[model samples]
Target chain A: MLKLISSQIVSMNDIEEEILDRKNRKKSTNMILCEKVIGQILEEITLSEYDLIICTGEGELGQTYSFFSSLASKDHARPIFFQNSLHNSTLGSVSLQIPNIHLGISASNGFISYETGIEMALASSSTKPVIIVGIDAYPKELLEVKERIYGNEIKLKSGACGALFLKDSTSELFKSHKGRVLTDICFNTHCEAPTSREVFPANGLEDILRKLSQNHTNFTVNRPGGDSIVYSFES
Target chain B: MNPVDTISITGHGLISPAGIGLDALWEKCLSNNSVIKNGLGVIPKSDFSKVTQFVENSKWCKSIPKVKSKALYYSLFSIMSAIDSAKWIELNKTDTIVIGTTTGNLTSWEDSLMSYSLGDDKDQTIESIREQSLGQLSVEIKKTLAFTGKVLITSSACSASTQAITLAYQQLSSKRSVRAIVGGVEELGKLTIRGFGSLKLLTEDNCKPFDQNRTGINLSEGGAFFTLERNSDSPYLLRDGSTVLDSYHMTSPHPEGKGYQKSIHETLELSGLTKESISLIHAHGTGSFHNDQSEGFALNAIFGNQVPVISTKGVHGHALAASGAFELGIILKVLETQLIPPSSALVEQDQEIDLLLPRKPLEGKVTNILKATLGFGGVNSSFIVSRRDDA
Candidate 1:
């Protein structure tokens, strides 16, 4: 059985709580988003014992543009602000901050990023705790690009979410601590339309967490390209 | 409960510094000569700065959109050739597809930024920034091949593909998927060039792993793919794969390579093999001071001087995330020839490292091969391929 030890959510405003390096230098928005999410998740759980920290998500627009623009600068003159501007930066920073974690993998599978992280956490959790994190920020700049191009209707916000998956034996201590226990997790390529509200990459995981809180229940997280991964829980 | 633990690699496709197709690649590998050197790319850069790279320019290369991300082109060509090579003509909706990459479609990403900055706002379409997520490789390949299989893209700097191969082994081991295409693809990009340059990790000279005077790495790009299934008359069987994070640093490895040693041991255990069973060792050997030093210690602790180590960077250069998959082709060659290529750029091997690096192509009865890659952000991966006795 797999159990969620602790989880946290972070939004754009959370960056205000951080005192970043090079105070005078600009902290790329993605850096802020990643650092905030990683910082909050680490606060909720100790990663020193985690066998794997699986961070899965396609980066949000802010970080994407930051890295891209830096690459596009004239004469290669943009002094690199972020060492790793790729989507893996989230995993990179998390690893640097918590250097004792046994292993970490950064994966991007479009909308299924979080579910993939959860699955990897379960599959590799026999030996030690696995901290699975999903983070993405729809930067204001990206939204602007979308609006200018597609004329978007619904507003969007930058957000991140993460969970710590521990084996049921050790996770027994958190049975009553508002965390959820897993009875089984199933992944399928056959398309199953979830009769549920659609949520974007980083924000919608709460639906699974909430449904799993019931005494016995199952939830489906639909991924892009019409695939569904069902997660069932029995407390 | 009755499933055998072995996973077969039916076939492979590759686009390397040597050439295209598996046979073309083996020809170069057998020669023990490097096709690496400093040169400008087909696409122009203002600085016109030249660096070592393994390039392929042909009709196949031009089959894609010709965007900034050379990875797209590399992956497309390699994946198609892989599918054809495997002759598993049909990609069922259930087949697993996983790709390992450092930067996905970086050229297109940089192109998008350049256009937007230059007032070409129309260029910022959904497709333009698609690669930002680093999932673009699979998206492009799936659509191009008309394959409906599920896809996963794993990133861990240079060790990306080896990790993907390891993940495939786990999936196959668990009976999750009967068939999985697992490998890595990478391309030279602005951030990779500048990022490494900023970190002062690039060697203006040819990268020489294990050499005492080694300076740094030469950034390069390539791709290779292998189809893994339950049973086949393939040349080699993927025995096991394992990943261990050194948790040492963001840009460098642990001084002692503790994580690397853990990964090697784990991989050996999973393969149900021992250090004695491993006939050859494929070293990451990026020629960087920290990387070689850390890896040398790991090799020493695991194999000591009992086994031989080979570095392909001298021939292929460093393909970043694609390096692992790209190097797998060489391992395939070694499996067939039972002869290991010597260190292409080694000169006066480092005294600190007691590991043996064959300075010339060495022939032997190599069967079980261990290929290990250590990446940035402390990711170390190892995968072993052994000849099936029954085959």
Candidate 2:
């Protein structure tokens, strides 16, 4: 059984503040948001206790734009920007901050990226704790591009959601709290939800965390293109 | 045997700089000729255009609108080839598709960005931007194939496809899906070329891995796919695999190759195999100094000079995320032919590297082969493939 130890959600506003306040901010907005949310969750559990880290998203689009912009202008792109432009760079940052975790994965499935991360975490055979983080940050520069692409129907937000999961064991960090047992989670390509919602990579996991906070035991989150992630929980 | 160990590689397809299809790639490997021209492992324009035209004319192209990205074309062509090789007319709704990619539709994104930068928004379209999503690769595959199951995309740099294969193994082992279409695709683009160039990791000459005069990697692009299932009758069985992080550096690997060692150890432990059981070690060997050195120390510590090792980056170039899948295809050929291809572009071996590097094709009683790949940000993955008869 996989048990949710603790989870944190960071809004776009908070991520913006963190990005602005950092003096040495060479990282991408997605990396900054991931570190912020994962940092909050680490306050509850020791970093060393986690055995795996799974980062999910399309990657640092802002950095990608910057790298391309540099090239378009006949300028040498920064090596750091090139390195951080990778989707897995966010996971690399987390691994650097917390050196104990030996396994790290960066996955992306667009709006259902969070669900994909959850599925991967659940599928892992490791019995130790795992940390799954879903992050998305749309740079202001890409707003026009996004507008042309997603149109008005889909509202893409910039934020991050992080969760700590333990398999077949309860951690002392959440011993006093009543942890929600994640009974089953799977991705369905067929849409069964009543209504369609905005497409944000981190929203599905964010919605689940909100529902769990309200003491809701069972719920489902549907993605765009008739895909849905069904979540079942037990107290 | 464990159910996880039951997963087999039923079929595979390839599109590399060497050529298209598994036969072309294997022939190139055996010929020991470096396909790297002008410092890039690129698919010949003829092969590229041929596959594009074939995909456009194929029945799979009827459903979706015209795709502008070469990455999508490569992926579709490879998947169709894999399914054809598997001899499956239809796919089950419960089947899953996992793709590993370093750059997904990057060429499209580059064009859009360039146009946008020039204030020319005429070419930018919704479909083009949607295609930029790494996940969109699998979605397009699903639409063309009409499968209503789980879709995943792993974008973990160089080891992305290896991780995808490992995830498919886990999914089938856990009974989440009975069969999976697993592969990795990368397309050559300005972003990767200039990006690696800025880091001074690109070589103008041939990429010579583990060679004393090794300079840097030659970036390449291609795709390879495999049909994995629980069928025991398959010729090749995916023994097991592991992915581990170095947690040491962003671009450079641990000097001692600690992460790679751990990954190899864990894969062996889980697969119930030992060092002596592996017939060949397909090293990542990007021809980059740090990667080759790190992997060299790791392999030396683990296998000493007992296991024969080879790196084919010189022939096909480093396809980044697709390199592991390309090597896996080569490994399958190695098992079938009972011959190990020589490491291409090796003039003199690096004295510091202690492992045995093959300079010529060796015929042996091949059975289990270990394939390992290390990517940027210290992601290391290792897996074993064995002949079914041996099992």
Candidate 3:
């Protein structure tokens, strides 16, 4: 089983402010939401070594790959990245700085896209820690739609990219102890109202995991609310 | 395992230059003719005209309010077709809507570029176009259809819609309580045209797929959608689907078509069917030298000379994200009618490839069919659909 070891939340305020500080910016959204969200997370995972890096968001790896290509002054870009821009490029970008890294991309849509990507990362290897980044700053137009959905008075705040460093219990990192799957997620997309109107947060994620670590057991039940909707079980 | 709960393709609606209805599209398919020509428009304005005649002919065009962007038109037109085909009522605000596109409103981008070059306040133009492009289309579709379900708008260059289809299949097969409306939509825009032009990949004339004289692909705009159900009275059954990342390149396929080969094998494997069971193959023959050569090599490797192969781009032009779904719709028609549509408008055939190309509609019972595609960003997908009669 894989356990989320440590989670890091880097608000766009830090690095984005850095990138914006350099350029005389006129573009309404200076956040470079995609670049900052993807780049900053890459920066966080630079120290640790991992078997694979998985990036999930909306869109292909072209722009993300190019950012890494320029950062790494390789004489020629990897044909693999140039051809397919495999999933590892996300990690490869940082791996260029980190070395001996393999990465893969899982660009899914909406919230589940991020969740599924995390699930994959956790399942990849029990011993190695996988970095998962889920950061989506609303697109310009989508911002307006979010505004409409949230209401005119409310502005959809840019989403923060949440990076979780996940490792399997079997890894040497956790050899002395057993780690268990914290959340078994399945989506209920058939609500009568929009999820925005119906979701309740799963605040117990951390506490439940801690309790399971002590008990080394399993429990399952249906719960509503939190960042996503579904049943949660802990052992 | 009797009829292991297959994904139901309850409804789909398509409006191409061929016509507004399935019958109309079938007529064009039977005639082996395409209605797409270079479009007539002002922004990124081209005299080349890859317009779908049905778009010009449909009442939907007259009903839609004039919008600044053409992407909205394509989005709306395809939505209407999908709604009509699916005959589905409004979702409880929880159904998932996934759409794919390469150039979301390229016309607007073209306008922005032209305006920016002229030192105009491109802010509003850029903002407006970007809004209506991909996410905007999903919002509009949600608003128009009054859908309350979650909306997922994917734009993964060429693999956009295929990803949508693949995701939808995974969700349903995973036993998730979800219904997905998945497909791709693309309207030709100057950005893509100019981009392809910059890359020297667009053909000056209509594309000729799988031909030795294949020049390059022609960019066009079209949208096709499938309303997939976990269980329902869909006209056909989508037995299995799969997506494989070539991890190869961003722009070109592996010269050997290894990615495509992997996708085919996985798709067939997922469907629990052998290649010998495939009655027909809908290939992603973009008429480009590289795509044709790579796809040709892949087909030869998989089916040898026996399986009949067809590429619709010769008639429909290359529809970007929607190409795979468009080809799937054609396969559905073939399955329903048991008639092999004529491989449209190919001027020459690649002699090195050993496969049958139907010059005219052929009568044959096809229980299972394969539709394969290779898109930009090294995303390749193949879907296996079993005829409803098979169930």
Better DockQ candidate (1, 2): 2
List, residue by residue over A186-211, the lDDT tens digit for candidate 3: 33433332223221111123223444
lDDT of each: 0.68, 0.81, 0.55
Clashes of 2: 0
B160-251, model 3: which lDDT tens digit per residue?
66656765665566544267777777776544554566566877766778887877887766667777887676658786555555555546
Pairs of residues at least 3 apart in sequence or in different chains that clash in candidate 1: B68-B107, B68-B108, B69-B107, B69-B108
- Every model's DockQ: 0.40, 0.68, 0.11
Question: For residues A32-63, what per-residue lDDT tens digits would candidate 1 score against the true structure?
Answer: 65556656767765555665444544553554
Candidate 1: residue B152 Cα off by (Å): 0.7
Single out the weakest 10-residue window by summed lDDT for candidate 1 chain A: A147-156
CAPRI-style grade of the A/B interface in model 3: incorrect
**For every candidate, what is the interface RMSD in angstroms?**
3.1, 1.6, 8.9
- Superposing every Cα of model 2 onto the true structure, what RMSD results? 2.4
What tens-digit string does per-residue lDDT give for candidate 1 at B1-391?
Answer: 1355457887787776666566655665556555666621122232111111222232223233434355766676666567667887577766777789877777666666656755566644544755566655665666555565557778777888988887776666656567888788876766677767778888777778889999888887667888898766786888667788775566778998977899899888877799998898999999899899988998998889879988878666888888888778888878877778887678889999889889878888888989998887678888898877765
What local lDDT score does residue B6 receive in model 1, on the 0 to 100 scale? 59
Better candidate number, 2 or 3, judged by DockQ: 2
**Candidate 3 to native Cα RMSD, angstroms:** 8.7
* Candidate 1, TM-score of its B chain: 0.90
Could you tell me the lDDT of residue B23 within candidate 2?
89
